[model samples]
Target: MRVLEEIAIEDLGVIRTARVPLASGLTVITGETGAGKTMVLTGLGLLMGGKADPGAVRPGAERAVVEGRWDLTRHPQAAHRVDDAGGAVDDDGTVVVLRTVAQGRSRAHLGGRGVPQGVLAEIAADLVTVHGQSEQLRLRTPGKQRTALDRFAGAAHAGLLADHRAAWAERAGLQSEIDDLTARAAERAREAELLRLGLAEVERVDPQPGEDVELGALVARLGNAEQLRQAAQIAHDAVAGEDMETEGSAVHAVEQARRSLEGAAADDPALGEQAKRLAEAGYLLGDVATELSGYVADLQADPAALEAAHTRLAELGALTRSYGSTVDEALQWASDAGLRLLDLDDGGDRVEAMRARVAELDEQVASLAARLTAGRRSAAVRLSEAVTAELSGLAMRGARLEIEVTDSDPGPAGADHVAFLLVPHPGAPARPLGKGASGGELSRVMLAVEVALATASDDEAGSVLPTFVFDEVDAGVGGRAAVEVGRRLASLARSTQVVVVTHLAQVAAFGDTHLVVTKSAVDGDATVTGVRAVDDDERVRELARMLSGQDESETARQHALELLESSAVGR
Candidate 1:
């Protein structure tokens, strides 16, 4: 809606760093070849969320950073973008946006708040629409054509287009389901048999959780039964046998040692401490032996219970081998199986219903396509006539132009296919805009279509046509025709911003805001980096440099002064 407020660059490749302030009128940029004219556009493109290239950074530099700042709170389209992104307007109703590309990443921000590139791009697309000759190459694609038309005719047709797309997606979804179910029919038969056999196998034994642990405990007790019984019998013999005093049984031996130490205590105190320690060990061993003897008396072996435990463990192993790593996992697999089995059983009915629904969606898409085609075809004649009228003022007086709408298969933009066809002179065959139209002709026709489309879309707000940027818009023309080209540009300027990088004084004379792009050596580097607005007298001097490549000549200066004066361009 407005010219860019600021562009800041730092170590952004060869740029090193530069900042520029822009004005809100026709701004002309004139420079020699390779003066970094393209850099300006590239910078704008990067800030608008274009892909970043680390290679764009200067060698040995750590990063490339380009920052663009815009105050767009007053722009309706910009306000809508802010509202959608959950952002608020500033006190001045100005939202400042900054986009940077550095260190192999591109990021954006709004009102100093970080946002994604997608959000910034949405706002940028509305704020600036660049239309250079190279930029126009993007128009050759049919996708671009459809997008522009939908955007130009957005309000009435965008919702219908969305509906068509949703229906198409639904139809695609059902088709995919049918194909998948058809492929799985045979596989399901085999899996169902395996599943049935597996369920029966696990169900017969009904293995419980921790069955293996219980089996392990039983096995240990059974294997140790004999050794444990023998050990308990020997301990019982030592403590309470009939030959109890032979070699002094455990109780009698400890009593003898205690009495001997009591007598020796008068001779040595160390012997007394040793005897006391031996009496404590003898008491603990006697208690454990008595307990073991009772345990041996009650020990019993049951062959049936051991066999049952082993059998349950084997059943659990089978489930673990087939279903999952653990009982919990096995249960989860069973739950999934139940759900899948239900779907497989009822899949036939579901497939049939989806087929019916897909057919209904197909009908809806076809009907919408028919309506769109009808609307486009009906408007073709009028649109062509309007463009033809605007072209006569550009230079060609009797050129023939026609709008062609060919029917096509359903696409995201409906079934209407539109193209602008032209015959440069009478009796010439009509051809598409790019193939037969000359460069100058192409520019004029583009201007005509844009202006007419803007008028037709007057009811819609926030659709500013793209600014026409041309490096050679005035190429190969002079006299009244050159003047006519300026008129055409001025006509376009009424609704769309026009920026022409040209050598023709006639074209430069048409600017509402004239900027001189000069290349100068800064710190011994040959760089084109200066841009400044010029006034009425200054405009004549710059135009003279462009016209005669000299300013000392009175003749060249007079012509330059006339060109500006005749156009009444008081920049």
Candidate 2:
């Protein structure tokens, strides 16, 4: 079974170094006043990621360390989480958790790897449940009472709560959407009008892709048409003169050079190669001269065409200034605005649809909340009967607990509030637990409720926690009542490990394993404490000390022996 195998502490408070071994059944830790019994729980608190106090460190020590070993063979999920955190569980299914407090800071480790203190807290939640005086105080709150009732309502009831929460979340989302649509109606209308006007302007201008750039080039050429024609004429005259025989013309000069090179070709082969190059050059010059003559003739400026182009370019520029840097970008903006306007126009229809959906969800939430309330009320009757039955054996004869489920405003957890009331005797009226119970009565009532829950719950909330630790939960109890407290603890231990730090020998006598915290003086004035298991004879002496201040008294020893025999028979 999953259990806390051992806890080892070093230099914490009065404890120098000690290892407390635990087992499957009831394990009791007992010691004299100021003998460092609380230090044992302090070490466990550190392992559970509880806040570290620098004052808890033993004087002259650098740091205090607490380590715990857990058997996780039956808890694969917890083991998997450790593995995910880069820690390893041993072959025998044991995981080691260590916490160290130095100065004012604390550090935690799982398996062999370092981890956040919160990691230890999360993993340990499923491994142990610690019940102390503080827990009894917390049980008085309304929130804790409701949680306890819901847990006792079982798994099927839990599913109903989940469905209700989901429905509430969905309804909230729809309500938010409807609120937004209503709040921003005027703003959305203004946006739609602006988009419509802009779209109309863009449609009227209707600029084409690359149209502005193309028109710019045409305007430049037409503005300087006369100058361009003059340049073409001069270049044409230079390449192919006024007439073919014109002196110093490019065609005439190349023709003369070709003839001279051909005449010398007969005397030298190099001259023939030069003559072929001159002939190719003459052909290229003739082609250029023809193109230049044609260009001069066709290059005429048209005022009407120039005016039309200027007007179109200005229209495109207006569109660009308002929407984009270019005609194409402006066109893209127009297309997007058209779609946005359509969406704004449909807002009314969408809001109507959403409101209808929200109304439907309201009905669903109300129906589910009703079902949840009914289930809780039914479970309340059974839980009250069960806890009242347990209180009879915990020294509160004729006492009974009554659970009340009342209606509340519907929310994620459903529309119900739960409160636990106590009736001290048959003739007394039932009052809320906090008001009707004394300190001793409250402790027993809390214990009875816990025992009832533990035996009744088959859900993960009850089954996953493998160990329970009680720190003087039997406070203000003695004699017969003390024996019953021990017996109930022993009963709880049968299903899961139970560790009790107590002063009652009646309780200690029922432990399957008994450990006592012993104190000794060191050096001149320093004191150190250790925890050790007691055998049957040592247990008797320890019990005697608990019954009376003197362990050597014959009568106290006899009472201790009798307590052990009676508790054993009860177990």
Candidate 3:
């Protein structure tokens, strides 16, 4: 989709301020050593959220800045991600990404709005793939080989891989559950026994809600029975005396006053009302005396009953001290403990069920892993043939590429170990990629693998091949081999954008758009480099210089022209 359109870099490494243009074809950058060729890649890396190196800032500069423009006309997914990050896309479907490194701090901006560095990284992942010497080294690992194969396995195989991972995860969870249950078996048993003992004790005592409070009242009353009886008798005597005739008694006194008032009632109406009130008061006093006499009689202390109440109170007290602070609280604890004991009782059954499920998942995972292995093996052959075809065009004629998938212990991805093997010729033993290939061969192999993957990606639904950036892809090659490398890169550019930074003139001659990084010294002290697009004449000079370190050499210029003409013809 030609995702990266251009990049503007400032105060980064040996480059001061330069705007490099890009397009949808093979674009190559060439320069003398230390002419800031790496700075261009560094800038692109920063835009892709690579680690910021404060030391890369030019001397006397406060910070280094790199900004990029990306066109999203065909990348609706990336455009949506930009919106989700609170960034905007230009009217022409372009979004600007900026990265700045100052001192030890780095910041990123997208569409003129501040955003997280990770946002840039996430977007870049689907928009660009950068390969350098370090990336070639990383291709040595089996893990990377497997990943490459999986990417070529298409969507159906990817879905199968996902299902396998899900099954493996479920199995791991069930296994964990079984292990935990086994490890804590004794602990759970002890806990259950303690609960049983507590339940038994509670059942024996049979404490009720508020039972202790009631028992406390009964004990206090029974212990003071004699005093209670005496108090009641004195009150009864004061109210009614031994007989009704007792003069000092409240009932008698009230009755005498009522009679005195009644005798004078005929003299005044007010005296009649007072007499009626005194009569009512005398009746009320007599009722109180009768009730007090009943209470005194009922206050007899039964020692056997008092002793039984005390014993019951003591049992309730023990329960309060152990289980709760009160009888009601103790009862609540028993209720909760009963429910917990029910759960503890089912622990063994739970463990058994979990083990059964784990066995079921183990079978499912094994089947899925076997399928995954089969899928990888099937895809490996196709990928090997495709990459070998690519290698043939990259000047590795008769070199056969083989993808080896071997059995391995089941893992999250699958149960296969993938290796990229190279058979130099028909009789040669198939050796691993990094082990047998030279620098140039490895370079071509990496390129071939990328091309194979990119071609496969074109068929997948909704898949847009990202821009390919290769750093020093022609590390060790010359003559016809180098020309083949250039031709191969140019061919790859037909479907997508290809950017390569190299010192080889042969590789650079094939570029649709050629950029040259030129270095100059100011005041014979400060060094600066600038990247600019070159015309045909300038390109010839640049290629001549790269050929023999002399831009004006007639012989070098002739060879440069011949190389460019040959690459053009191949294109």
Candidate 4:
């Protein structure tokens, strides 16, 4: 893996202004505490798409930005991503990835095409992983642990899981059918009572189309019977006659006028037509009077059964609120509930079927779980042995490691319980690493496990694991142990890029390339710091300072030169 170029970062938390150029091989960065050693890590983390830390924005700085230029031509996994996103590859076969973070906006680009944060994280997961000076807690979470174990187990179990789920679904479906049938066994009696009561209510009311409107009008007429009759008689008198026979008749006047018009029409044709129209109108008015007289005579109140029907309908309206939205909907709900009650009373056969299915599933799951447990047991031993070997190289000499497996009840993944145990020194009782190992010890144990698992994965898959970062793994160790750690890390780098942040001169000497991190005042600001890849002499000076506290001392210089020279010979 190679990082070709980078640009300046300004007012980004503690890093006032920093520019860095990366090299193809290992690069070690060393700096004093608060010299913004972590600022460099922060910048790298952002470029690699880690979570944004708003606090990382320099005090009073409006935004924080990190820009990186990585040459990804030879990166096997990165090549596929570039091609997939339809990005252009340069003539020199290099792909450029840029990440930027502002106050409220974060953006990424590949070959100048805008990409979302998720895409950058995906690519960055393959590029780098930051493990602090302590163990990574996220790796030990149950979900991640289960996933890691499954990934270690490989592809054969994928089909098995699918088949098991399908079988479980079939059994579950059958069980649901049985439950439904059984619940219907005793619902007949209730249903009959419900139907009879409902029918009686409906029958008593005998509601018809437009019944409410018609009955309302009838009730109003009956309630005001005498008043309505008197009004109608008055209307009859005005239209034709209420006493045409007993008094001077209005009809007689109309007939007399018609005679006058008939005489006039003999002289004028228009007056003869008018007289004809008047005679026709006289007959129509007499017919209307006969009808009105009969209608008024029959205006009597009905007080008997209208009240009874209305009361029955009121009961139905109340039932409408409790039972269902409407009469039809209520009837349907009752029907379903009735069936469920019946099944509960007499579904013996279906109940037996349900029991049989549960029993069968229990047996099937137990069998599959046992097999899964065995496979995990075998895998745990191999993983533990490899990790133990790696742990010793990380300076935990004479350490005892174990993978303890316990039988758990059936679960979605499997039935074996797994945990890593450790004893730091000879004759010590083995205990879980979280309980037994110190911070540094736990860090080494985690590294061992990560390195081992990464080695066992497919080439494309392995490249994306958390980078095996050795942060001062050589703090308290040297000689053979320190050398071993370096060798193992170098070996890991062959498969996945390894980045180490260290204070140990021995570890810095082992790096294929060296970098020096420094702090300085920029226009009198305390936060200004910078980091850049160091040339041979600068690297020697840096390593010498780390080795002795006296960077300018001749003895420290000779020692640093010898260490670098020896590392080169060994490589």
Give each model's whole-structure lDDT: 0.68, 0.87, 0.88, 0.67
Candidate 1's TM-score reads: 0.76
Per-residue lDDT of model 1, residues 166-280, tens digit only: 8778788888989998889889777776776666665674656666667778866765777777877887778645344446477667767878897898899999898888788
Clashing pairs in 1: none
Instruction: Write the residue-wise lDDT of candidate 2 on 313-397 in tens digits.
Output: 9989988999999998998999999889989999999999998999999999999999999989988998899988888998888
* Winner by TM-score between candidate 3 and candidate 2: 2
Cα displacement (Å) at residue 136, model 4: 5.2
lDDT, candidate 4, residue 356? 91
How many Å off is the CA of 187 in candidate 1? 2.6
lDDT of 4 by residue, 158-184 (tens): 445555666666667777877775575
lDDT of candidate 2 at residue 356, scale 0 to 100: 93
Q: Identify the leading candidate in terms of TM-score.
A: 2
By TM-score, rank the candidates, best first.
Answer: 2, 3, 1, 4
lDDT of 4 at 39: 74
Worst 10 residues of 4 by lDDT: 459-468
lDDT (0-100) at residue 78 of candidate 4?
Answer: 75
lDDT of candidate 3? 0.88
Against the hidden reference, what TM-scores do the models get? 0.76, 0.81, 0.78, 0.64
Residue pairs with backbone overlap in model 3: none
